[model samples]
Target: MNRTLLIIAMFCSASTFAQSPVINNAEIDGSGAQYQGNLGVNQAAGDLQQQANARAIAVGHGASATTQIRQRLRTVVDPRIDARSSIQGDSFSHGNGVLGVNQSAGASNQQANAVRISIGTQPQSIDDSVLRQQNVTLIINSDPTDSEPGYRQIATSDQAFTGSRGVIQLNQSAGVGNRTANTLSVRVTD
Candidate 1:
């Protein structure tokens, strides 16, 4: 008796995330006694997660099993911000003021790929092979010259404050890949 068995499986997963450009302009002016608290601006874009799994099994005489899994991810982003504050004239009392700006583009990406193959047959000869491939691409533009169109300039005028001030903060980021994981397993028995 002669028997032949063949099994082939292929799995492909692709994910692409693109974030649009961000532009912000802010201006504040005070002339009299003013109290401001908890003032903030935030922007974020392009976050993705993906997973893929494949399995193949063959059981017989002269059996062959093959499995392939591929995962790809791409991200692109740009962010821009501009802020200004001015306090003119006398007796401009400002107390306990907090101001902040946060910008994030193409951040936090995760991917997982898994493959399993199993083959069983009579006692003779066994051959097994496994292959895995991963590709990633990222592009980001966060800084530009003053003459370029993507650049933003803030006012450099002097600010005058008569009272106490709290805190001022600014944060910026682009193209940050957080975590990635891949797994593969193959088994053959006779």
Candidate 2:
């Protein structure tokens, strides 16, 4: 009798596991918008909210060289992210976010040294993910060469001007053999 009951229970459990996956209702909601299914969204705060995000994530080993590399981590330079937003929204505001900048004036003085870094090895069974909320900007900049030079600077004069809106300026200067990390974080404001 016990053997027969075990067989019946096994069959019942098997039937339950054979069903297909299902989602009764798929939905997403944000300020001034609703999505029944995944499509798109509009940031209401702007007449046209222009947003950009640049994120790079690597997991597992690099399957190119000899034995697979379990994991490698790295960061470079006086990394700096900056932006100032106060203008009203336009009818339609758009953005063109680029991953590469090739020039001599803007991002010309950037040097990256041996950026070999190792954080940790992932567990046998594990997962990783990252999520970013609204108006989040990350800026990494500064000297990649951490070597201080014995060069002398000629006496320079400072200029002064009158401002009405109350100027807010961030002036950062890093000498040789220096590491700088700058993060401008602003919370939600009504």
Candidate whose TM-score is highest: 1
What is the number of residue pairs that collide in model 1?
Answer: 0
Model 1 local distance difference test score: 0.41
What is the lDDT for 148 in model 1?
34
- Candidate 2 TM-score versus the reference: 0.18
lDDT of 1 by residue, 85-190 (tens): 2223432246465534333334333333334445656433333334344556464665655533233333322443456375433333333443343344445666
Question: What tens-digit string does per-residue lDDT give for candidate 2 at 22-128?
Answer: 21111112111111211112111101122222223233443111111111123232223111111122211221221111111111121111111122343232212
lDDT score for candidate 2 against the true structure: 0.22
Best by lDDT: 1
Candidate 2: misplaced stretches above 4 Å? 1-149, 152-157, 160-175
- In every candidate, how many clashes are there? 0, 12
